[model samples]
Target: MPTGLRASDAPTLQRLCGSDQRLFLRIGQLLQAKLAFTEPALGEIVGNEALKKLALDKRMREVDATSFATLLAEHGGDGDLVLVDGEGEAGWRVIAVVDELGNPLLAPAPAEVGGAAILATLSPALRAPVEGLLHAGGDEQRAAALEQLRYAAPPLSVVSELMPMLLADGAELVRERAINLLVAAGAQIAVIDLVRALQRGDLAQLGRIADAVSNLA
Candidate 1:
């Protein structure tokens, strides 16, 4: 016997679901079951008509408070509700609102793994939450991440920082992928340094540099 959702809980749940589709499917399943059984507590939290209206109103407004308020009077607030000007507001809009924080949040995407404490340090973890993606996953995901790296205009110093991981990767495929990414990213100086490291008896670091130089020839 399943329960139904209450009036208050629906809006928040709906908002969360709408924000992320995959999450929505998971929560939607639970909500559906609760709705079927008339679950009092679940219903109370998930079925709020007022909240639902607010969520809908928020959506209709989109991310622009002024335009949103003009169309709908429910979301009128004069404070910092509207993000305008400056780096903080811009960061919030890009990271929190659009979820595209990789560039704006982190100076260089890979440096995000071991850089400062802000969003950059959290970028790698955020992008690849699963251990499989971060640690020793298959070629597919690593290749994908490497491809993304090619498009990023990170500093050469950052590329130098990441060279060791690429050079020491256990998988040949990962090494190859890293070489391709570095080359695509125009890290010629870093490539030369990696080649020099290989010449200095760093056998462990030869794989990626070797592959990259071979491609150059």
Candidate 2:
């Protein structure tokens, strides 16, 4: 499969990588190679014992294996480097997969879907639960609802409905979950919320926000 990006993506990607020429080049090479990997293949490569029992695997053929391994080792711990969740720009999930052997894969996600669009794609059985818990629920219920939506909706789809509001949720537990979900989703609101807090002279979260933004970037 072809990587979703076009030539025009170079500039944008370079900026995203902070103009690191080498990093940009490595990312570009991986995109051009258009690699796809299965979980078992990656598991064997990464030394995951349970996953290493697979019969066959996809091996590296194009990209530099060493560099790819370094990339995975550096940014692979958290899902941020590979998966752009609901809160990011509505486009492909940039660098969506890394085989841990030598290559990466980029895949498209829904361009931009709202809560309704997300719900429309769900099975009939899931619709009511998702709908009921979407806007109304206690702290725990809201958290579970968000988790349910993860499977039914694209990363960017829920941002409009859940951001900022969830950030300021009355329950500390709910607010914490919202923070984790939004940050994982790559939501800009997370950063904006942090900046706002900083502006209000809240220094306690400064380091945390910086780390979150760094990962998001």
Candidate 3:
């Protein structure tokens, strides 16, 4: 999504830091503390404080070809707290708040999210196009839509409509996509449903086989 980090941006960023290692390290430490685990595998890392902190520093510094400032802009993001998706080739492999761009004007008052707040964050709008294809499109289109949903990382609730594809007569790829997304989201469903789907699928295959046999006869 983001282009290359400009070479000139480095000196500008360094000048802004003013060579204060203590302050810089402190900012880094704060970022380590604020890392949130939206992903499951990354969630496991977040559980370990010392391990996660170690990974956090490396992730922030892992610009590779890109500058740290650029990675910060691309993944660290544009907010008071720059949120970084750590699950790339390098870093802690978790989502982190790499740095705070500026202090908030108002006093810090964190509040619990309500139902509407939760819905807004999930962003139902992202699923609209995919849902359209899932409802009426062919297997290939359905599979592609599922891939899009997977990448988009919609909320667990978004998976409900897609889950039925697992038991659908065709579109094996769509079923795989739906299951993978559900597993990644960590939304548990009944094993019985999956078992039944497999059984039903097998039965359908058997029926087709029986029809072919009858034709041969």
Candidate closest to the true structure, highest TM-score: 2
The residue-level lDDT of candidate 3 at 167 comes to 31
TM-score of each: 0.29, 0.32, 0.30
**Candidate 1 residues 46-111, lDDT tens each?**
344442343334243233434533433454322212222124312111101212222354244444
Q: Clash number for every model?
A: 22, 2, 1
User: Could you tell me the lDDT of residue 51 within candidate 1?
Assistant: 26
What digit string (tens of lDDT, one per residue) describes model 2 on residues 185-208?
665754555534422334455344
lDDT for model 3, on a 0 to 1 scale? 0.38
Candidate 3: tens digits of C-alpha lDDT, residues 1-217:
1111111122221233233333223223332233222222233333444334433455553433245345445443332222334333223322323322122532223431111223334456664645454464688877776676677776666554444333332455765666666666555333322323332334343333332222221
lDDT of each: 0.37, 0.42, 0.38
Ranking by TM-score: 2, 3, 1
For every candidate in turn, the CA RMSD to the true structure comes to: 21.0, 16.1, 20.8
User: Which order, best to worst by lDDT?
Assistant: 2, 3, 1
The candidate scoring highest on lDDT is 2
Clashing residue pairs in candidate 3, if any?
A: 59-91
Q: What lDDT does model 2 reach?
A: 0.42
Q: Give the distance in Å from residue 93's predicted Cα in candidate 3 to where it truly belongs.
A: 47
